[model samples]
Each structure stands twice: as C-alpha cells, then as structure tokens.
Target chain A: MGDNMSELLNVKNLKTYFFTKYGTVKAVDGVSFKVDKGETFGIVGESGCGKSITALSIMRLVPDPPGRIVGGEIVLEGEDILKISDNEMRKVRGKKISMILQDPMTSLNPVFTIGIQLEEAIKIHQGLKGRSLRERAIELLEMVQISSAAVRYKNWPHQLSGGMRQRVIGAISVSSEPRLLIADEPTTALDATIQVQFLRLLRELQEKTGVGLVFITHDFGIIARMCQRAAVMYAGRIVETGSVRDLFDNPSHPYTAALMRSLPKLEEKVERLASIEGQPPPLNDDIQGCRFAERCTVAEHQCRLSYPDETEISDGHFVSCWKF
Target chain B: MQRYIVIRFIQTVITLLILSIVIFTLVRMSGDPVLLMLPETATEEDYELMKSQLGLNKPVYQQYLIFLFDAVKGDFGKSIRTRKPVILSIKETLPNSIKLVTVAFVIGFALSIPLGIVAAVKKGTVWDNMARVVTGLGQSIPTFWVGLMLLQIFVVWLRILPASGMDTWQHYVMPATCLGIFLMSGVARLLRSSMLDVLDSEFVKMARIKGVRESVVIWKHALRNSLLSVVSFGGMYIAIMVTGAILVETVFAWPGFGRLAYAAIVNQDFPLIQGVVLTAGAVVMSANFFTDILYAYLDPRIRVQV
Candidate 1:
C-alpha cells in the first residue's frame, strides 16, 4: 500500500468534446493534470470553463453520442485508461477510481434508502454479501460522520438534508477505498457552513486513507483552502498550474492575476476588483489565437493571431500566455 | 395521515351524493316513466298503475331519498328489463371483467417495461428499433382485429388454444391479447419516455461515479425513479382498460360487465344502463383515488403539505 501511494494516478493531454448538432464543443480542449499519490489536486474555474469536463474525462464517464473524449491519454497508475475495454473500464471504475458528482440533491437516488444504495456499490465491486456487506455499508456511513449511521441508513435521500445527502454520497464514493477519487463541485449546491464541513470531511478522509484526490470547482477559495496544488482553467484550457502558495502569491499570467484580484479583500479600499471582461467564447467556434484574447486586457496582435504554449513560470508554476 | 385520509373520504362521499342525485333527477326528467313502460296500448289507469308501481306517485324529493336509501343499502332496485336486482346483475358480470382487465394489465406491464428499459439502454440500436416496430405494430392494428387474427392463427390454424369464450385460463389468451396489445404499446411508450428522463438525471451519473454496475445502473437507479410516470399513468390505463374491455369482451363473447353493458346499451334498458354505468364510474373513481394516495406516499413533500 505504501509503494502504491508513492505513485497512484497520472493523466496526459486529455481532450473531452461535445458533438452537438451545431458543432463540436471543445469543452475540455487539450486539458491535462495529475493527481499524485495522497494529494488533493484542485481545478478551479467559472461555470462552463471545462473544470467538470476534465473530471468526467478522467473517469471516462461522459455520456456519449453527444459528448466524448475525442483524443489524448488518461494514464491511471501505469495503464492508459482510454485504451482499456468497456468491461475493463467498469472493473477499474468504483474499484480503483471512484467519483462523486456535484449537486447533492440530484446525485443520490431519491426513491432508495441510503443503506440500499450504499450496499449496491459495495456488493457490485466487492461481491460481499449478507452480513458482511451490511456491516461494511454501516462502516462507510460511520466514516462520513453521519449521526446514528445505523438508523440513518434506512432513511431515503429525501429524508436527509442536503448536507447529510452529500455526506451519504461521500460514503458511497469512498466505500470501495479506491486509489483515486474525483469530486466535481461537491459543495457548490450546499450552504456555506455545510460546504465548509463537507470540504473538511473530504480532506480528513483523504488524509486517513491516503487516496489521491482530484477536486473540481469554480470557487478559488475552496481550492486555496483544500488543495496543496491548484490548476486554474479558462475557456477549457489550464491558464495556470502550481502549488496554492505559488499560484496565489506570485501569480504570473494576466488571467491568473485577474482571478486573484477578483477575490474580496477587507484591507483595501478598491478602485476596481479585476474582472474578466467578456463572456467565454462560443464552444462551437474554431480556435485561432488565444481563446481568451477577446477578453484579455493586455492581449497583443500576436496573442490574437495564435494560441500560446504553456510557459514554465518557476520550478513549481506553469501559465499559458505570451506575457508569461 | 389519518386526518388527510378522513378529509379525502369526506370529499368522496360528497361527490358520490351529488352524483346519485344528479343521476336520479336526469333519469326522471328525460322521459315519462309511465309512457316509457306502458307502450301505446295502455289506458289512463294502466299508466297510473305503472307510475304507482314505480313509486312515481311520491314527491320528487321523496323519491330521491328512497332511491338513495336503497342504493346505499346495496339494493339498486330490479331492472325493469331483466327483472333482476341491479346490484346482483352488475356483480354477476364484474368479476370476469376484473380478471380480464387485471390479467391484461399485468401481462402488458410485464412484457413492455423491461423491453422499454432495454430499448432506452441500448437506444438507437437493434433492440430500440425492434421495440419501436413492435409497439408501432401493436398500436396500428385494431384490438378486435388482433383478437380475430390470434383466433385464426392459434385456434383455427394450429388448433392449439380454444376459439373463444371465457371457460378456462387457456381461453384468456385471445381476449387478453386483444386488450394487452394496446396496453403493451402504451406501457412501452410510457416506460421509454420516463426511463429516458431518469437516465438523463444527474443521479444516474452520480451512481456511475459511485462505481455501480451497468445492469444495476438501469434497474436500481434509473428505473426506480422513472416509476412515477408509469405508476401515475397506471390510473388512466386501468380506467381505460375497464372501459375498453367492453368491446374486447363482447367480441370474444366473454361474460363480463363489458358484454353486459353492450347488451344493456343495445336494448336501452334504463335499469341495466344505470347499474353498468355506475359500476364503471365506481371503478374509474376508485382507481383515481388509489393513484392519488400512491402519489402522496411516493412523494413526502406532497404529504407534508397535506
């Protein structure tokens, strides 16, 4: 287990696109990140910035027909998950890598009791049955800090509050004790206090189990608080990637700098909090230069003519912009 | 829950009382009891004798109370045409129709729901296409025609099952199939749409993220939530089933309320008509009531408000 934690998950150049009647939406266009052994890696961006898409792409759980991972590799551990068979993928899923989706309200099955749903995941992946499965399910609920895990187990999703439901989801996701866990905006729908509690619970679970974490959200505050390393996404591209301290203290990219300025500060009487000026480009349009050039305040003619490669800003930070 | 139930019960009673009074008044107003019964040969006293027999000598308000009393006591009075108590006569035929409709409904659900789920899961593939074709074919052909076609193929052609009439379980195939075809198509369509809605729910994705199996994904997660549409639509389906069974029963010569109603309608026997109409109305009302109760049980938010 110690050796396994030394190197758990890796992803490279992953692209997830939505094939619509209008055109292909490059939702996660050439996005790449890694979740190393026993670390919380956060992806932060605004809505429709492809933060969630990258998470879905890693799980290979994107609904097909309209959306698909069109290109690139997702190497989980030593194996390339994109190349695996469907059956193999199913085996890997929930057993080795599990995910908990956003929106606690909709994520849990409304009709079923939390225990039955929890047992369902345990039984499928572990093939444990009868008393053992029941015991394990109770234990998972306990791990998530639900009160009276035994009694609450019989309650349906609607019976529980939104925060309780989120905890229940957390229980189900980590029941398998997978090497990697992907949480897509798990607290966005929760109340502020509940959100803090849920995030704290996730961090505690990660520390206890030493599971690699890929947490996606639009809120940079959450990223700053929960993650050791953070990546900032803009228009489906990672504009900045580094440790929380490096990304925040010496933010290099103009987009990264703008994002930092947007955060509310009590100390300063602000002339202006930095704001990205334009709506994100229509996902269907073909990309030429920088996808953010239309919105970039400091964008030059070259920035409009062609997209830029990722620039290494330091030993730890990387940003994608010409001014880097 | 008890209070809620009491409120519902009170409401149903008020509704039934209004219905009985309206039916009683309408039956009286439409045509003369004396003329309708006596024919052209009747003298004045003879008309008087017929009116007196029907208790028409009593005041309109008095007549309504007497009728309501008899109805509440399960005596709907003897049919002028059949000379049998209306309640007993209707009861004699209701069981058979219940059997026929219930069998048809169960078989229809059994056959279509799983097929619908499979179609949605393997959507746009061979299974979906096949389901679409089967439901299409089921919908297009008139039910009686299907009964006739089945009778010919299985009875006349192969001589495997009975030709017609409700004698044994073996006899139910043609009649039930006749009714089941349309229901099967309806169930298939309902299940398909509801299953699609559920499949598209964020919960399904969440379940997948939890590492649930593909088979479990469809049945345990998607279909469970999708049941609201199927179960709610079940009320309307069962109501239609009772109504539609009349034709199917008459065609197959099944001794059910449908056949009885058909005969009563053709003969224009007011007593029998009243009985049969009341029975059908009762069944429809009952199905709707149960459906409402079920909806409340399934969704707690509704129960909380109540």
Candidate 2:
C-alpha cells in the first residue's frame, strides 16, 4: 500500500482496446482515476467515450476476442487485480468490487427467481445457505425498499417494474458488502422521478455501508447530484478531474467548459442551450494529440501537434490541456 | 395457469377433430379400398358383394358419421385387411413407437444441448467449427442412409448387434441413433443460436459481475433462458419422430405403430390408417399443449400476457 492506501480502488493508466476486423478501437486509452473509501467518483462522458468499458475493465469482465485490457493496473484495496489470476480475480469481484450495469430491465436473469439472483452473491461470497441464505435474501430485498420482500423474492424479473428491478440489482451488488461499487448508468432506464429516488437510495446505502462508488454516466445533472469528485472523459481520456464543486465552479479543460455551457440552466433564460460543435475524433489508431482539439472552440496549433500532459491547477484540481 | 391449460385443452380437442376429418376424407379419397383389395379380373358381382360386405354401399356422409361415432366410443372399427379391431392393434404398437421416440429424444438432447453450449461458448474456434460440420452432416444426410450405414458398419460387417426387432435393447441402437442424429443436429443448431443469443444478453454479463462462476453463468443462467427455444423445438421434433417413424420402422423392421401404419397404407386398411393418423394427431396436439405450458412457465411475460 502507498500513502493513499485508503483509496479503495485505483485504476492507473488503464488501456482497454478492441482488436476488431476494421482496425483497433481504443475504447479506454490510458484512463486513470482513483475512487477513495466511501467516496462517489463520477465519470461523465458521451455514450462512446468508454465509461462503461472502463467499468467493465475494472471488473475484469470485458468481452474478449474483440476486446482486451492490454495494459495498466486495477489496484483494489491493496492488491493489483490486473496482476492476479482469473480465479483470484473472481474472488475480488462481488466480494471487494461489484458492479451494477445499465438497463435494469435486462440485467437480472429472467428465468431465475428474485431470491435466487439476490442470494447468488451472498452465497458465493458469504457461504451462507439454507435458512440463513433465505433470511439474507429477504433482508436484501427489504434493504432495497421492495415491499413484501418475502413475496417479491419468489417473483420473476419480468414481474418486477423497472425501478424495482434496478433496486434488486442494487441489492445484489451490495449483498457482499463490497468496498467499491461501480454503477454504470444504473438509473438511465428508470423514469425521471424513480431515477431521483433510486439515486437517493444509492447515496443513502453508500453512506450506511461506507462503500466507494464509481458512478459512470453521461448526464452532468446526475454527476452533480451524486458525485463528490467528478472526471470529464472525452474520447476515452479523462480531460479534467477535481471535486464536483471545483469542477462546476471553475472547469479547467476546454471540453469541461463546453460541457458546463451546454447544460440547461435553471435561473438563466436563453433561446437555446449551448452545445459543443464537431464530433469526437475516431479513436481507431493511437491518437497523437488531445481528442477534443478538433471540436474545441479555441484550438491552437500546439494542441493539434501533440497531446498535453495532466497539469495540477489547484490543490485537488487536475486538467489536461496546453492552454492551461 | 389453469385457465390457460383449459383453453389450450379445448383448442387441442378442436384441432384433433379437424385432423380426424381431414385424415378420414383424404384416406377415403385415395380410392376405393375394395377395388384395390380385389383382383383385376373380378366380375361386377364380386365388386358389388365386396362393396355390400364392406359397408361401401352406404353414403359418404353416413359412413363418416359412423366412423366419427365409433371413434367417439374408442372404437375405430375393424381393419379392412386384417379384420381385427383397429384400436387394439394401434394400442399394442403405440408403446414401441413411444419407446423408440423417447430414446431418440433423450439421446438427441443429451448430446445436442451440451455440444451447442460448448460451441456457443467456444464460438469461432476448432470445437465450434467441428460442431457445425458434424451437426450439418447430421441434418443434411438422409436418415435411412444413415441407418443403413450404421447397420452396414455395426450390424452387417461387425455382426455385433441385431439389425431389426425390438425384443432386446441392443436392437434399439441403430434406429434410435439414426432417428436421434437428425434431431441431434437440429437441436444443436437451434440450441447454439439460442445459447449465443442468451450469452449475449445483459443478464449473463450481470451474472458474471455478481461473481458467479463461469460454469454457473453459462449452465444456470444462459442455458436455462436458451432452453425455451430448445424445448419448443424438441416438442415439435418428438411429434415429427412419432410420425416419421414409418420410414425408419420399415428400414429396421421394427414392429411399432409406424410399421403397422405402413402396412395399412399399402394394403388399403382405411380403418387402421385412420386410427394411426388419429393417434399421431393426438400426440402432436398434446406435445404442443405441453410445450405452450412449458414456454409460459419459462417466460413470465408469456404466462401473464397469453
């Protein structure tokens, strides 16, 4: 363990690439971040910006053949998970690190009972079974705020509402009481009202369990509501990283500035919301420079020539830009 | 669930009734059985006598009514060629046919599903390619040819097993294997595609994230969901095997309902043919009913919606 051994999960320079027939897809290129104990670290980016892939890579559950985690270390607690064997990694997953994926409607196995699915992690990690497992499953269901947990445990996934199913997923992920929980757009499929409630529930659960969370999403609104620290990801690279308040008040990177400008304001009235122009550059080969340079409003010749290194702006704020 | 079963049951009855009518009329329309049974040099007197004796003198509608009435009472009348009760002979041979088909179904599923899952898990690899080639051959080559080949190798050349008869379990090997080969390929292909679809589903990925072992993820989660298609396909395959037993029965000389039906068809035994058709129809209908129930149970959405 290092000086910041308290950091529950540290993903250092993670590089996950997809070797497809049409060339390589640099899904998560040298993405680096750390989620401290009991902290919510948000990774905000557009759909193809590799937020989910980063989460998957950390879990060591990335689909192979086309995708591979080519480099970098995923250090959880103390051990570097990337260096461990798959069998050992399986022990790490759900026990120390668990993930709640996107699309709650299809996340749980449809053929299995809610109880069986909830009990799966508990049984695997805790070795509880029979009456105790049943009790644990009921407790987990109730923990997620599902009414009549006993009855609901026997229900199939298709019988549950989207919100309820997502809660069940939350319950399953937390069953092992993992130190770090990576939630990849857990509430994206939920209704707006339900999303708030779910997020609040997650936040409360995290507070109660003291579990670190890697909240990955595209919505800045959710990032503001949930995250303590936030990173703005652009084309698989974290362009800016700081406390939510610092990032919101004074974003350093151009991409972060553009993102803040594009967000809909509550107090201010405008004819149209500001949107960053230009599509993100194709992440096929090794990118030479800042990915946002092409889309940047104030791009310089130096920005296009080569990639900029991360610069510490303040005590906790870091930005990657030549302009800084 | 009860309501669904009841509704399906009624539907099955209606379907069976329709099938019986079709079989009766179609078999009758194949031409006069008496004409076919009698010699070509038979006089008009012989034709009239045979017609009167066989109740061919009655109108078609009367004959259908008589047939339906007898069918309702579990009596399919006497066989035109054998002069024995049609139902009695069918009842005697039905178990053998059931046995053969059941064996085939078991063997097919036992081999196919695992192979399919393995192929799906190891997609695009040597195991997958080999599975594709083997299953493709199973489906493409004729069943009779396969049976003959097995017989030539196992029975004729090696002289290790009996070629025909159902007296010993050894006799069931060639016919069952031949029958199973066809179904095995179909089941493998179907299960492979279905397993691929299910393995690609979000639930499977979520299961892996839950720290579920790879075997549990594949066999428990992926396999269970994938089985919906396999089970349905299997039900249809069973019904097909029951009816398609004719060719296999003839080739192996297995004394099943299929062999009896084959003989009936050649000898113009209308009552016997009708009995076999009616039995086949019932088997198909029941299989469909069970499959629907199984499907609904597997998918709660279907259980609630339909």
Candidate 3:
C-alpha cells in the first residue's frame, strides 16, 4: 500500500515455520505488512498468534533447524534480507533495524554492565572507542531519560528496576540509530503508570529520531494510543489490516469483530463481556479449510471447506473472511 | 563482601573442627592401630609398652583434644609405619597431587568447554550426539579402569608413553587422562546444559538481534553466563579429585597424596591417616573459599557489602 520513498520496511508473504516432531507449525504463515517512516505499526493478537514470530523473521533471528523462514521477502530499505548471506543480514540487524523484547529483566545480559551492553551495539555499528564510546553510551542513556547515566553505566542488569532496565534496553536499541525499531510487547512487563510513561518516552524518541516503529502487543489500549496502522493476526495470518480507527470502529473480519467485542469498555453497564467461543485451531501440516471456520459464528458449508482470500474493503484496509 | 567472607571463613572453621572430630573418632573406632603395628609373637608386656608409646592408652576424647591442638600447629604425630612425622610426608606428597590435579583440571576444562559449546551450538546434530556419546562413556566408566585402559593402550600397545613412576611428565599422562576423562564428562555435561539454558534465554536472543557476531554472542554473552554454574561445579570437582584420585593413583603407581593416603589407610598408620584427612579438608575448604570469591566476581548480584 505504501510507495517506495516513504516505506521503511516491507514484509511480503513471510512464511516462518517450525519443523517439530509432531508437524510443521506455520508460526508466521504468509503474513504481509509494511511500516512507513515515522509511523507506529501495531500487530495485535492473542498468545501463540505469530505476531512476535513475524517481527523476529524480519530480523532473520529465528532459531534455525527448528524454526526457519521457508519463503519471504523482508525488504528493509529496498534490500531483500532473506536472499543475502547471514554476514550481510548481521550488518543490517542493529545498524539498520533493531528490536526491544518483552521482558527487560531477562533481556539484558546479567553479567555485563549497562555501558557494555549499549557499547555492544554502538561499537559494532558506530566504531566509537574510549571517551567517545563512554560519552556516546552516556548520551544514549540520557536519551532514554535515565538520570545519572554515567553512574548507572557501571551497574549490572539485576541492580536496576524493571522499568529502568527496559529504559537501558531502549537506549541500546537506539544506539545505532536504526531506520526501524520493533518493540515486541515492550511495556507488558511494566506496571500501568510505567507503561504510560514508557509509551510516552517511546513516542518522544520516535519523534526525535523519526525511526519507524513496529509495536507488537495484545493490548487494545496500546493500539488505540500508539499505533497509526494496525494488523490483527490469527492462526499465524493477518486477518485484518487497516488504520487503527478503522479497525476499531468498523471491523470487517469475524475474528476481528469477535476480538473487539471482548474488550472491556468503561461507561457500558454490561453484566459480562463478549468473548469468542472455542480455541484457535491447532496449526498442522494438513490444515484443509479455513482455520477460524469452527469458531466463526456465521460459518457456512463453504466457509468450512476452503480458506478465504484477502479482500480490500476500503482504502488500504484488507480482511480475509467469507462474509467480507 | 568482607563481611560475607568473614562469615564464610567462620563457617569453614567450624565445619573443619566438626570434620576433625569425626575423622579422629572414626579412625580410632576401626580397631587399635597398635595391635596391627606390633609383631605377632609380641608378649602382653610388649603390647602394653607399644600402646603407651603410641599414646593409644589415653581416653578417646583426651587423645582427640591433643591431636586437634597438635594438628593446628601442623604436627600430626609420628607415623606408626615410617616413624616419621606424618605431616612431613603428606606435605612432601601434596605438591605432586596438586600438580596432577591441576594438569588434569586444565585438560578437562580445555577440552570439555569447547566440546560443550560445540554441542550446544550444533544442538541435536551429529556433532552434538557424538559429544553426548563420548561424554557418556567418560561419565559411566570407573577411573581405575580408565587408567588401566589408558596404560594398556598408550603404554603396552602404542608404547608412546611411560607405564608408571612420577619421574617424567610422561608418567603423568595415563593417570591425568584417567582423572580428566571423568571430570571432563561432568564439565562438558554441566557446561552443555548451562550453555543451552543461557543460549535459550531472551538475553542471548536479544544479543543476537543487536547485530553482535554469532561468535561474540556465544562466547561473550552466552558462555560467560553459562560459566557461573560451571565454576561452582569446578570447586566441588577439585575437592573430589584431591581426595578421590587414590584409585587413579594406585592404578598408575603415581606418587601423590591420594596414593599416600591409600597406603596409610591400608597400613592403619594412625598419624598419617589423620594428617591426610586434615590436608584433604583444608584443600576442599580453600577451594570453596575461592569459589565464593569467584561467584561474587562473576555475578554482581552476589557481591556482598560490609
């Protein structure tokens, strides 16, 4: 949907599968999305919904042997990263694109100091050393609003609180000044107030650097607050992709509609919240029909027999459902 | 850190004191060493004289108190067999055991860590499976048998290394290898699992996603974190090797504290046994102390204050 100049990342038909003992798990099955410069693209889904896997696939950091990108085009700045050698992909990873994971407590190496972890990305990408390196590290820390950054540089991950450690991680991810930053539920581990502060800080950083952001989370409130565009993933596929307002106000796909219904709304005196019935189908090699058919309230005979192709409903808004 | 160390040191002292009392009483209860020392034709009067001479006539608690006081000053009395100060012999032989254990430990660590890293990186592949098989054999096989087998293959068959006697470095090959194989298996397994655990952590994945080289990700990030458990295990391993190398030593006829301790045990050399036990206890305690310090160094969270 995006033109060449504005698009920072374009992931097309990305298929990352896990070859397990039981069967092939299509973790990210033909997921397509794009993020433009200075935009926040949110990917929302329940647990095991392949949103995080899609983000990981873009970085080419998927665990091999078990998990692999069977077919895909992750075009970061007009280069197809999947076709390039691992060595080439590495150069693109932190320097061109970086990620902040979910758990800050376990995301930073416990043994190394904050400065060392930050310098890991900076020195590799920027080649700064000595006082310049130290200053750059301090600068990055300060960028993330960590006061007394110089003193905190020597501290280990365990010494810091959850929110502070995450800030340090945020500092590390931005050290290379990448084109795009993927934050996979970065604020999920933090408390409510901290989450707001973190989101605000991220928005501030994004505005300062103009880096494209891919925010993956199940939280609807985050999508409403942060994302410009959003993709709703189900059974390893994007069921709906549109502007956040469009997806919230007018969900076309049955699965997206069900999800919207489940959200707890204030000022509504409902006795109980609506929830989608049944579980998402087990992704298997021989998945014959529409994965969501069994759970879909309006599923017909045809809907149970074949998968629904994506149909564009409005300007740049697409949904995959028989009803659509 | 200082307070923690002081508290740890006190605990070690108390532990050793309890161990000393246990060793003294257990060895005494095993039967009179004087009876074993005296000749078969010796009369009752001669037995009495030998008993008094060796201080076996004293009550058990009194004897332990005297031994404990003397042991604190590095005196473990005279060996019933050699009639030499038991401490002197243990001191003379301890360096040999230390040297052997050091060599073995170096060999074990050098080989096991690499093997472990490879196994973890190439996990579930043929290389990993091969490592598992080799380490499995190392874990299951007895040290004495391993020593004999090494002697048989390297000495008798290949004729590349010496059979026994600690005259040359060549003599250490068999026993060191025997000891090392067992330690290597443990180190390799411990390191492999540790590496796997660390490698699977979100931090390692984060490191990889940060464009750090795979080598750096594995060695710098993963291996260092994995080494925490490996180092702790190493402390206990060194203590085991110091005391348990008796089997390896006997098989290879290597002159070390283990062999001396073995001989002392068999000969019922009261003073020599006590000396060897004390030395072993001290060695273990020292290893644990260093391990604690290492723990603090490796993990900043464990660094105690005041």
Candidate 4:
C-alpha cells in the first residue's frame, strides 16, 4: 500500500478545540496521519468521535467563535499550510487541497444554479471565463457522470435529486484538480444504491486524477471497500492505524475488536448483534486515562490510570493500548 | 412563468373585489353621508330629495351593484364633500404620496439591508450592539411622535428644513425620515436574524471551503438569501406607507393619499372614502403580487413550487 508514492499531506499532533459556555471541547486531540499521492486513507469513528472535525481542521475551516485549531502542523506538498498567510491559504484551498463536505443536500447553495457554482470555483482558481468557463463547467458535470450535463448546468440545487446533487458537489470540488481531496461522510445522506455508485465514481476519479483522498466515515465497511490504509478513531484520538488488510485480519485495539464484533456477519448467525457497553467520555471535561477504558472489557488497572503510547505491532500496523 | 403571472393577476382581481365589498359595507355602516351633507334647517321633504338624488333610496345590494359597475368603468362617482369626481381627487393626491413613499421606501431598505448585513457579520461585536440600539429605538417609537420630534429638532429647533407641505424635496425630509425610520428598524432586525441563519447554513461553509473570498461570501451569497425575508417585509411596508401613513402625513401636512383618506373619513364622503380604500387595496394587492414574483426569482425552490 505504501510502495514508493510521494507524500501528499502530512498532519502531525493536530488539536482542534471548541470553547463553549459549558467548557472547552477537545474535538481533535493530538491526532496525526499522512496521505501519499493517489492513496485512499480512511478515518473511521462513531458520531462525535471527531472524524468530521479532523477533516474541517485540514481545510482550516473550523467555525471560530468557539472552534479553533489550537495546535497542528498540516503540511501539504512540502508546504506548512498552518504557517501561511490567509491570502496564501485561500489560494491553497480549491487550487491545492479541496474538500467535499457531508450532507450534499445542504452542501450546494440553494439560490445558485449548478453551472454558476461550478463556474465560480473555476473562475476563482483557474481564472477561466466566457465560453471556456461554461464549457469547463459542463465538462465537469459530464465527468461526474451526470446525465444531460448541458441541461443540468442551469438547474438549481433543489431541482437535482440527492444523488445528483452529491455528484455535482463532487464535480465542483475537483474542478481545479486539487492534489488532495477530503470527503467527510459524503454518502451519509444518500440511498444505499446511490452510495455504492458514488463510491465507485470517487474511486474512478481518484484513479484517473491520481489525487490523494482522505475518506471520513463511521462505517468500517466503507473503509475496507475504499481505503488502502485505515485509522480507527476512538474518543477524539486514533486508537489504531494500519493497512486495511492488516487491521481487518488482526484487530489489535479492544475498541476496534468491539466494533468488528458489533457488525453483523453473513456466515455467523446470532440472536442479537454484539454491542459495546457505556459511552465515550464527555469531551468538555478533562479525561484522565484512556477515553475507552470504562467501556473496554479487557481494561487493565494501568489503562484506567493513563493513556498508552503507540506500539508498532507490524511493518505498518500500530495500536495504542496497554495490551499491545 | 406566464401562467404564474396570469394566476397571480386573477387572484389580485378576486382580492380587490372582496376588498371593495368590505369597504362598501363598512363605509355605509359609518353613518349616512347625506345627513352630513344637509343642514339642520332642511325640511324632511328635502332630506328625501337628497336621499333619492344620491341613490340612497335603492336597496343596499342594488347600490353595491351600481357602485361595482361604475368602479369597473373607472368611474368612482363624485365626492359628497367636494362635489368633484372621486377619481380626480385620487389623481391629484396620489403623485404626492408616491413621491413621499418612494423616498421613504428607498431610505428604509437602503439603510436597513446594509445595517442588517453588518449586524449579522459583526454579531456580538460593538457594531451589532449599536445596530440593535438603533433598531430598538426605531421600532419602539410611535410614528406620530417620531414625526413631531423630527419637526421639533430639524424643522422647529434647527430650522434647516421646511416644517410642512410638499413644495420642495426639503419639505419631504422630516416626514420621509419619520416614516422610513420605523420600516428601516423593523427590516434591519428581520434581515439581521435572517442573515445570521444564512451565515450559519452548510452552503455558506461550503462556499468558504471553495476558497471564495470573504466579501463575496457575505455580500453575494449570504446577502441574496437573507434578502428573501426583507423583500416580503418591504413589499407589505410599501402598501402600509401608501395607505397607512396618515399619522406622518397629518403631522407633516403633506397632501398625500393617506391625508385624502383621512379627510374623506372625517367628512363621511362616501364616494371619496370608497375610492381611497379601493385604491389602497389595489396597491396592497399589487405589491404582494410583485413580492411573490420576486420570491420566485430569488429562490428557485419557490419557483418550482409555483
């Protein structure tokens, strides 16, 4: 999976915190990962486990009156994006690293036509206009496999179906051919059939463009299907990271093992699906030990006392647990 | 699109017909205009003659039919008080009202939209607080009092502007400001909240992620969506200003439609009263019709629904 591909994005110790009236929420705490050019990296976690926030942090778009990226070095193509000026960062976005957000239903502006929106990104990043701009916009629509591309160009967001809107959003994100594309649960709002089609389309686009894709979702099924390497996030931190084959074949972290058990298997028949007990720790309060310790069936006394360091179990597999 | 417009037009006509019936019945209930027209020394026979002359001797429904027929022909009968055609009076006064209301509408929306945008963008900042204070004062203050205060400050004390009448643009200053201030504040409050909601929407976040400039996001994307609420409010406001600016018009001595309506009510001039109300109702309906069209234009969702 890691054979000689140039690195596209390198994020180290990224910490994004949200200061609310109640207390500060450490959404992404000391998270770190890397994506090589043309690689598909998946971040899997439950709702509120900070997978979305991590993607938003990479985009440098955490809504500020409360949320802030407190610490991080997000380097893309040998450039530290965090250190650049806002003007320079604007250029980097769309042109260098674009993002496809969750919920395509609300991702596109309601008042604008799909064509105008597609053209806008091209106009700003590629500086295209007039006949060329319109042509490029229609071409993007066709590339996303949208039927009646020319007719769909003038159609508003409300005119398109959920699947079609997501496709248009996909087209707009990749219009500038960014080196890295961050898709945050792009299929959650779509139907199961449409989800499969969208994922396939994403993989095809990735193969054609050779763009690094950071796929964020809670579903491990998607991780296994789309990712070359995968990270299992638990309570705002990555508990396990490895090649997809390694992680699936030999799950190391107790949390990962619990998640695997929870999934309904086709071969094994059961009365009820296996479920994890208890909840993740509240992010607002200070967490003293392993965030998953209370819920871990095999938690040791040491696991309750403090967090564990990452240990390399294989050539690429790493797990953070006292057992490891 | 043409179908929508035709449907809206038919709806407007139906609305106007209903409004005419309401005004016609209500005006008659106000008391006999003939009594007001006659002197105390008039004989009972003279009263009968006056009643028959004015066609009050006819049944109420018959009188309404006659009124409706004449109204369709653009003949609003003669004013009982002035002894002139009702349409002539409306024609004479409507231009002044248009001039005043147009200026006020311009001032209200021009100031309110920007104020609302600023308040939303700078939410929780000093500018937002200041806008809150301004809108609060504008909304809370009565229109008549505001008019008088402007008269007291700008006209009476400062003496920089005219006190009454619509001879010059200078005369419009205090009255238009007084009228516009209330609208401005209400719209600003509406726009501020709407803008806040739009700014928080997912599409706005998407726009920022697209590397669009901050100014473009706020002014173009956010402002256009937020203006939907403002446009609806502004449309109704124009109707209100045209027919309901009696307080401001009376205070400023501006010879406008509102003032004409006020005088007709006082004199119990049946034709004039009916004419003024029907005209005001038409204006209101037309304004709303235009507002709906604008809504369809601004939002494609509404257009598809239509």
What TM-score, to 2 decimals, does candidate 4 have?
0.97
DockQ of each: 0.59, 0.77, 0.84, 0.81
Ten-residue segment with the worst summed lDDT in candidate 3 chain B?
Answer: B297-306
Evaluate residue B64 in candidate 2 and report its C-alpha lDDT on the 0 to 100 scale: 81
TM-score-based ranking, best first?
4, 3, 2, 1
Per-residue accuracy of model 3 over B1-306 as CA lDDT, tens digit each = 787788878888998999998988888788877778879999999999988986779897788888899999999888888899988898888899889888899899899999999999999999999999999999998888888788889988999998888888888788888888889999999999999999999999989888999999999999999999988876699777975589988888878899999999898787798899888988898888888888878887787443
- State how far residue A310 of model 3 sits from its true place (Å): 1.8
Worst 10 residues of 4 chain A by lDDT: A1-10
lDDT of 4 by residue, B19-74 (tens): 98998899888888778889999999999999999899999999999989998887
lDDT of 2 by residue, B54-115 (tens): 77799988888887888888898888777899999988998998999889888888999889
Q: TM-score each candidate.
A: 0.92, 0.95, 0.96, 0.97
lDDT of 1 by residue, A1-324 (tens): 665456667667778899988989999888867678898998988899998888888888888978999889887888999999988888888878988888889887777789988998898788999999999999999999999999998887888999999999899888888899988899989999999999999999998888899988888888889999989898888888999999889888888888888988889878877677878898888988888888878989999888889888788688889886
**What tens-digit string does per-residue lDDT give for candidate 1 at B1-306?**
666666666776776777787778777777775687677987998988878888999998999898888877877777778688888878889999999988898788889888889888888899999999999898888887887788789988999998767888998888888898899998898889889989988889877766667888898778867777777786688777876788788778898999988988887677777667766766776776677677667654445455
lDDT of each: 0.84, 0.90, 0.90, 0.90
Q: Give model 3 RMSD, 1 decimal.
A: 2.0
Winning candidate number (DockQ): 3
Clashing pairs in 2: none
- The predicted structure with the larger DockQ, 2 or 4, is 4
Clashing pairs in 1: A289-A306
- lDDT by residue (A260-281, candidate 4, tens digit) is 8899999999999999999899
Worst 10 residues of 3 chain A by lDDT: A282-291
